[model samples]
Target chain A: MREVILKTTQLSKRYGNFTALDNADMTVYRGDIYGLIGRNGAGKTTVMKIVTGLTEQSSGEYEIFGKTGKAAENEKRKIGCLIENPAFFGNLTAYQNLRYYCYQKGITDLKQIEEALKLVQLSDVGNKKFRKFSLGMKQRLGIAFAVMDNPDLIILDEPINGLDPIGISELRDTFRRLNAERGITIVISSHILSELYAVATRFLIIDNGKVLKEVTKQELDLECSRCIVLKTNDTKRAATLIENKLNISDYKVIDSGEIRIYDESAKPDEIGRTLIQNDVTVSGIFESGVSLEDYFKQLVGEAQS
Target chain B: MINIIRSDFYRIFRGIAVYIAIGIMLLAIGVSIYMIQPGYIGNASVGDINNENFKTSNYDEVMSEYTLDELRAMSLSDYRQVMLKVTGYELDRDILGTNINLYYVFIFAAALAVTVDFSGSSIKNTLTSAISRRKYFLSKLIFVNLMCLIFLFANTYIMYFANIIFNTKQFSSDISEITKITVMQIPPVLALAAVLTGIAFITRKTAVFNTVAIPLIMVFQLILNIVAAALSVQEEYLHYELQLMLAKLANNPTESYMINAYLICGGIIVLFYTAGWLSFRKAEIK
Candidate 1:
């Protein structure tokens, strides 16, 4: 079984009468890029802030690495977060700023700073002051800080907000590299669906301080289609049987041997049985849900409605 | 806590503000000592005090007996006493070195070290992964007290040696006496630093912290003096306030006065530190 890196059950945060987070539940596993997808003020950043111990929860509880309370707080040292915008001393250079963080984090070896700078492609401009950096550069610096300590889990809120296309692509590669090579669990939040879609293995859709849905990448891919997509050895035979036996004519043969049956009433088990009885090899059969954007919008809109 | 202090040191040394503040402090010291040098009155240094009209009838008769050379040859402290008798100017060299102005330095140091972090959002990074709120607040208090004490003692000694070098032996206090005065002043100055630390934690914004800190002592003094005068309070009771006590304690305070100062200063330190920690412990790092 995959290691549960972080889990929150009914975690909440309230400011006065308005709740910033309302009984939110989230779970992350080791090596998983958990994307928190929500619009602005939807408690996406609030969860990240709370988990990192930058702020306290009003109620509920959370654990890091199976530890709770003070133990869980101690576990926070293994997690790095960049909440909201990149917070740094503007007057100090990138190297100097990281040095300040290094001291705070109690990092003794100075080489980690260099390694982080190189990982974010900021090694060359380490001497450049933070105030003079471009927005993209600032975002890169934030990512560098998150990964600097070689944390077991890194939480980034809107990590791709200010990046250019090339920068975003490079950052995706960095995220994948960190997870793939070092077994780091990444929890990143963003309002932009496509950006999270590019790197996240699992996603949690939140709206109005509530979690709408949670789905994995494969499940999300399935949810992107609106029909039962069936792959078989014999497409002609399968199509004939689907049309004649099921009387499903609103279907299209998408590929060489794959067919998309758009009928909502179409059952895959019956179709697979019929196709197998008719000498057609049923390789795969599943209901295709919808496009990623439409699926995300549907979830959020459904939650609100 | 050590790590936080180290990081603060790194940040402070890199910034130009600390250096500028120190320079201003030294300049203020020089000008202050220069103002109390006895030879200088306002902008011009009066070569002969005998030439000035003695407004007081009693000291005027006394001054009429001494020649200009004899008056000029008098020891600096004795001359100052004669000047005090004749001109009614209170000129005690030790008391003139520093007053409540040192509190401004303490406030600035506390603001730069503590308030700037919150205002710049840098405290989020520190508190998130590094240390607990308790340690953060404790480190700030310790560092501010240490830093302000350095400035305070620097003023005391620099004034001591500076007075001797410039104004000659007559105006100077004994080194041991100067040390006694400096030792007695620590509690009150530390209490002042503690108050600033508390303010920094509460305000949590550089602009707001400075706005409160800069005029705080003066405003506090004004309010107290106004209340005291309105009530027709006795002069000795005015010294009960730490701000006034700091100024008066340099003039060879009695044992009772020392005991009173220690009590008041200790209370201030406790009150402000408790308030500061209470504000910081549950404070959200926004």
Candidate 2:
């Protein structure tokens, strides 16, 4: 529904014999919180770097805001990014560091410097050198630098890598505010699928430098079909009864006592009655939906298979 | 380009390694001055021990026959020759007071600046900006040479003041000749800096790169100087051939036949730089 701000077609990056990214086709739409999810060394950073022009691709092409080559410079102005671990001059103050970055980006507004610091919640760092800032604070500063220009699109790579729970929660809230209020499209890469699930509107799952699939938030929501989690004295008996009576065999006993049934069409009451008749004493029964972590694991398993 | 240059300048100015090396150079120069200034005696002998009179004629004969350690036990004349050879030709107060030593400081700057950029992820970020590779390389070359020029002028000015303080009478030695010498020195110094920058970019690191480059550069200059000398070129021109040609052409350094040397050497530098950029542009920054 939203306009596409960035796109890549068969973009590939090769390091000698090894292909770090292979035919990665990705589209980042405007006003969409696009999550790039993958494991370590999954070519997430490579894709980010290539798209940002920090690196070159061996084959294929990428268009930024309908621009290519030197014209990409103009399109780059609309996108802000923090790819990989952000490095700063250790001796410079946080403010000084941001000022240097802004100067490089050709932004002249000193007022935005303050706003950047405030946006990252690093205002209280106050004259502290970059070396002294905590890892979380440094990560925040990187985010601040990325969004300082109020870019239309923001790309962050593991922006919450070093943050604590509270810091991460705060950053999550900040991202929400930025998306909801400013309508800035964000493309963030992270290995933390659960954290991504809370904020991402769309997802691109990558492994071995290839995009396996791209799914929307509504599709992802539909993925979490309602199911029953049963804790019974005998999981074997529960499984047998469900299979024979309800024609269900696709279920897994999480531990020794509980079993999760994946069929959405089966009624919970019918399953309860069948289990009782089969003499499988279910001590507890609760209906819940699948989580992002579960869906991610399934996707990963499917890809591997 | 300005931003990158400013960042490079800040890094160089703030580097402890740079200042430490500067301090060491100044200390060495001070020691040299203390050792040889007029009547100063470094050891049992007067500063006259290292004069050219003892070094060239007699020292060569003695050194060719006797091993180095054997000279330590020889007669005073032999010992004087040995010491003189080790100490090198007398410090020409005319040239010495010119702060010619500070020219090496630019060499140090060029090496450090280029080496540091190649050390980590810095170069990737620097070149990735919306600037031509040529402009990026040129800006660095310009800033480094300018810094070297400033240091050269400042150090020479101070050394001249020192000569005045020491009451050396060489300041008035053919003002035209002194100016020729001073102006002639700039080309070689600038050339050395440019060559080193190119070498650093090619090698891309200090430890192994310098190990290989330093010897190659020294050997190249020595061989080139010998060739130039054999061809009856002036000593100044020979040195210029080795050091200043690239920088001279880049900055339009001189108006003489030296400009020809500059153009030739500068062309080589451009060629090397183009190669370096192409290599770098294709380099995988993992």
Candidate 3:
């Protein structure tokens, strides 16, 4: 029964005839990693920006730390946000950029600059300019700047964008560390559903400027129950045999040697026998649980169609 | 507020603006020195008295006739009269181009300052850092004003020092006139900067807006000057006779005291900040 740090009621934003965010409702509880899942233009960034006061909503209301007002700016002091692309001084070094933000927040802890850089694992880039950093490094730097203040609520939009697997894993671990070690509530918006599931404790799926569902980790686990997985060397042949012989039509042959059947009852042994009898190479067979990617496609497809 | 100012100052001083401002000041001093040199004008001057094509023939006649001693004597005895006549004298029609321009450096510096925010994306980051839009805009305005002041002072002092070091020209001692002229120019510089800052706040792209704005502003200022001159109100109330007077009120003082300049600049800053705050507070920041 953690307290709610942020709550929005029917918050809407419009740009002329285009509604960017439509009567969206969300709540970020204390010590929670709330995942905001959406496509490129699904209004995730708009929601984060509105809550952070970087943008004004056309209608509806939001409360931050129990404070409700259009000009309730003081509550923002407890929140840190990195919206959209990482905005920073390009000519400044990572350290200098962090220091600039620290100064702006009136945080006199000079050691925070070093700590921020260290947290991002960019301590070696002491004097290198930000423009020279890779896209992954820039994304990490954006996160570092956001979290350096040690604010109670941290909101990140597209945090894993342009990040490699290693960098993505590193940031995921950092998010967990921040939440568990520091008791900071995190609200992250990202298109990477798998990574979001890896670090987030709750999910807020949005589409076409509206929230489709707000599910917790327990709900997501419940929804992501057993999914049929069939691995075979002859993926195309296996997929064709599964659709034609097994009559499980909706299936996807991913990568070089993997076929996934959405139906949980479609046993891999039956698929393996069908593949073997059909002259397809039966390399591996198993029943796997549903991954976040599968769950996301299911959720998004259900809404989209 | 102090934090915003400090951060803004660092952001500004670390960019290309430092080089540009220094470059402008150095170039101004270099040009002023060249212009004030004893024989530098000879390159453009002709010895022929009746040569109508010669741009500085009249000034050349005055200079060629007077020896160093005579010039020194005139400078010591009737410096004000000599300077007034020399400064007021119209150049030969051939040497005088179609237009005489002033405040190119000021416009350049102001435009650079206004565009820095867009080119760097620091404005967005700054506003999101627990600082209100109003305070952020104020800090930026203060940073711009400080940049302008530095350039203005640098240009003035560089010109003075360069003339003393390289050229043998006697620096004028007309403090009241110089002060009036300097004071009169400050308001418009501030206003021009404010206007450009507003445009940058609205457009949020330096390369595009500045490319279009620089020439457009030049033309607008030219037209405004002509219209103001034609209206004849400048001569009556506004001190269009000087640079700063164009943006100042009719009841403004002519002295070099910075209070009036500060007031005018402060008002313009408030207007710009208000506009910028409104625009930014509503902007999507996409």
Cα lDDT listed for each candidate: 0.79, 0.67, 0.68
Q: What clash count goes with each model?
A: 5, 2, 2
**Candidate 2 lDDT by residue in tens digits, B155-248:** 4444444544443432223334334545655655565555666666667776755676545654665677667768987644543444333222
TM-score of 3: 0.74
Candidate 1's displacement at residue A299, Å, is 0.8
Which ten contiguous residues of candidate 2 chain B have the minimum total lDDT?
B38-47
TM-score of chain A of each: 0.81, 0.79, 0.78
Fraction of native Cα contacts reproduced by each candidate:
0.70, 0.15, 0.70
Candidate 1 TM-score, true structure as reference: 0.82
Worst 10 residues of 1 chain A by lDDT: A218-227
Q: For candidate 1, please provide the TM-score of chain A on its own.
A: 0.81
Clashing pairs in 1: A223-A290, A224-A290, A225-A288, A225-A289, A225-A290
CAPRI grade, predicted model 2: incorrect
Query: lDDT value for candidate 3?
Result: 0.68
Q: What does the lDDT read for residue B57 in candidate 2?
A: 37
The residue ranges of model 3 lying beyond 4 angstroms of the native Cα positions read A227-291, B37-114, B174-181, B225-278
